[model samples]
Target: MPEVKEFRLPDLGEGLTEAEIVRWLVEVGEVVAVDQPVVEVETAKAMVEVPCPYGGVVTARFGEEGTELPVGAPLLTVAVGAPAETAAEPASAESSGNVLVGYGTGAPAARRRRVRRPGVGVPPLSDGSADGSADRSAVGDPAAPDGPEAGGHRRSSLRGPGAAATGGEAGPVAVVSPLVRKLAREHGLDLRALSGSGRDGLILRADVERALRAAAAPPEAVPEPTSAVAPRVPAAERIPLRGVRGAVAEKLGRSRREIPDATCWVDADATELLAARRAMNAADGPKVSLLALLARICTAALARYPGLNATVDTEAREIVRLPGVHLGFAAQTERGLVVPVVRDAHLRSAAGLSEEIARLTEAARSGTLTPADLTGGTFTLNNYGVFGVDGSTPIINHPEAAMLGVGRIAPKPWVHQGELAVRHVVQLSFTFDHRVCDGGTAGGFLRYVADCVEQPAVLLRSL
Candidate 1:
């Protein structure tokens, strides 16, 4: 007989608790090889293909596509081994060495004796005698009332409807999945009073969750008799804050609530910067991006004002200055806005920063950016200018001390060289956590950035 092994969903790391099934690669009764990609799931961070460890016939699949399942929930069941003669090779022969989130490759699992219904594992005795009773005793519960003669049986670990029926007066409730029962227990719901919508009236987790929600819903308020009916109120559409959007919302909310932030803005002449960029690109190997140039400028400014590249240690009542500049730049994607970080931005040239920015931006747009790529930033550069805006006091990416916002650089009327002229001009807005420094430090940092923008040669000293 083939031994049935159940595989559970593994944690995809980064503290993700659940994933939604995007697609299934196999179906029931299909033979699968070890380490085969069984299902593709979308977690809060990224989409991942989960592989199975056992190579055998797929006995069952648990969740449907589009179903969201918690980590450790059953993914599928595989039956290992074949006919007695052909399956002489131990079940360990099908064990996989490839490891996933929760499961790791190790010694083949030792076979354990389990009580299962007939046609599943061991056959039950036909005679209504001592042999049948002894079989029941071997699998625990000699006291169980479901005997061979009763036309129903019970498994020690997995109790079906028959086992529920054998539980004295109330009999057995139709529940096969333990997750459903656990959900009911956690929510203080009684399964006996609810009707299940599953096959053979088996209780499901959705049923339990539905019962919980119904129990939680407030009672309808009684309205007194009125002369007129109230006008129908418009219903507002609600978008679920999850995935990238949820993460952004949480960080922004925290930054606003905890950080005593202030903003400072200045207009800078960018004709020289544009000319320098053109000259560099005209003779360069890899084209340098304007954002990358701005990023380099920010890094240099941070070296002069180190306090801006730091996070607040509220518990310790100290500001912790970071050593390396892990500069994060905001990129707008189809999934929403994401900030992909470039490690050691201070060490990179404008060209190097440009390449990394391109790679990370592409990854962000494709929704392939990992959790590591999105976190651990000392400062942020948000060029909202791409959206054609002139100025914005953008929120700081939480835990980071400051964010530099750049607006559109266009031909504007400005006093250049003591005369009013149309020059390439841009607005630079600096938003900093007030706890990290006073207005003097913030003003100094903004002034230096403006100077770099006005005179690109000033950055040569830092380079």
Candidate 2:
């Protein structure tokens, strides 16, 4: 006899409680291997392929694509230990260790053919039925008067259709999608009173919407008006803030509400920096990137003004100065803006930094960056100059102390060596949490960066 198992969605790290289903990798009636990716989900941080811990024949899947499921919701069911004729080998009860936060799986199992029991009343695997028998009272069966199809209306067996219902007790409401449940709750609709139209009598959003419309409809007895009337206005389009956009909104909102922040800007002649970059790239070694150079300068500036490279612990009422710099650079991709962190950035050289930045940028554009790659930054270097902008007061990434914004480096009129001349110049804007440091420290840090930008050799002293 085959033992059926239920696989629920696990907690993908970083306190994320829910994720939207992007795509399904496996289908019902498909054989899956241990620790094999079964579904792709988009959380607040990034898109992740969640692997199933159990290796068996998939019997059923719960949600559809684009459905947002909370942690711990049932994802699918697997029929393990099927008969030898059905599978290549018998499945062991042991699972491979710890694939996600909550679940584990054992060695990969051989592929097996999907097994289907006779009839729809077969209780779900969660019901713990040793014999593979469908629950006859399952939803959607017309014969199931006391089932979910009755819309929670329980009746006395002795009485006919006109008899009063007994107990006023209702059966389970067949609603699966959380979005549908939320919609009904927000509109104050009773799920038990409405029968579902979906397979298995599962309630859907369309059913709820139709009910609302019918409730709001005017009486048919009202006579049609002969006079011309104004046209009806179209409803506005709504976009849900759920995945990356929602995360950004939440972090930025918290930054604004909790942190007392300030911004300072300065314009610098970047001719030497540009010349130095060209000279460095001209060498036979790895080519240096302008952003990498800026990042290197930021690290040196933080070394001198470590106060700006720290976070404020509100509970302890103290500034937590980070020992090493984990630099985050903002990259805009088709999905949205993301800040991928470069670990131990202060320890990397110019060429090393360039390599890391390029790799992270590529990962960000391809939507492959992990949550670990997106978090833990002591400072952020935002090169908005790529957008061809002059300057911007960027919002500080929450929990981090400061962010340095670099604007477009273009030819500009400047007084160079006591003469007015066209020079490559760039604007530097620095935003910091006032709670971490005073304006003096912030100004010094910005001045140091601007100095390094103006004179590339100035950075050599720190190196």
lDDT (CA) per prediction = 0.73, 0.75
lDDT of 1 at 187: 58
Task: State model 1's lDDT.
Answer: 0.73
Measured by TM-score, the strongest candidate is 2
Which digits, one per residue and each the tens of the lDDT, describe model 1 over residues 132-173? 321111112223334432224332322333443346333435
Superposed by TM-score, candidate 2 places the C-alpha of residue 347 at a distance from the truth, in angstroms, of: 0.9
Clashing pairs in 1: 164-171, 164-172, 165-172
Kindly report which residue stretches of model 1 are placed more than 4 angstroms away from their true locations once superposed.
29-31, 81-235
In candidate 2, stretches whose alpha carbon ends up further than 4 angstroms from where it belongs are: 83-94, 99-227
Q: How well does candidate 2 score on lDDT at residue 269? A: 96
lDDT of 2 by residue, 1-463 (tens): 5677888889888888998876565545445666766777788998787777776666667665567999999887877654323333454444556757332234442443323332223234322234533221212212223433222345322222111134433333566554465466546677666667776556778888998888778747856679988857756646678788889999999988888889999999999999999999888989999999999999899889887889988999999999999999999976688999999999999999999999999988877888989999989999999999999988899999899999999999999999999999999999999888889999999999999999999998998
TM-score for each candidate, following the candidate numbering: 0.68, 0.73
Clashes of 1: 3
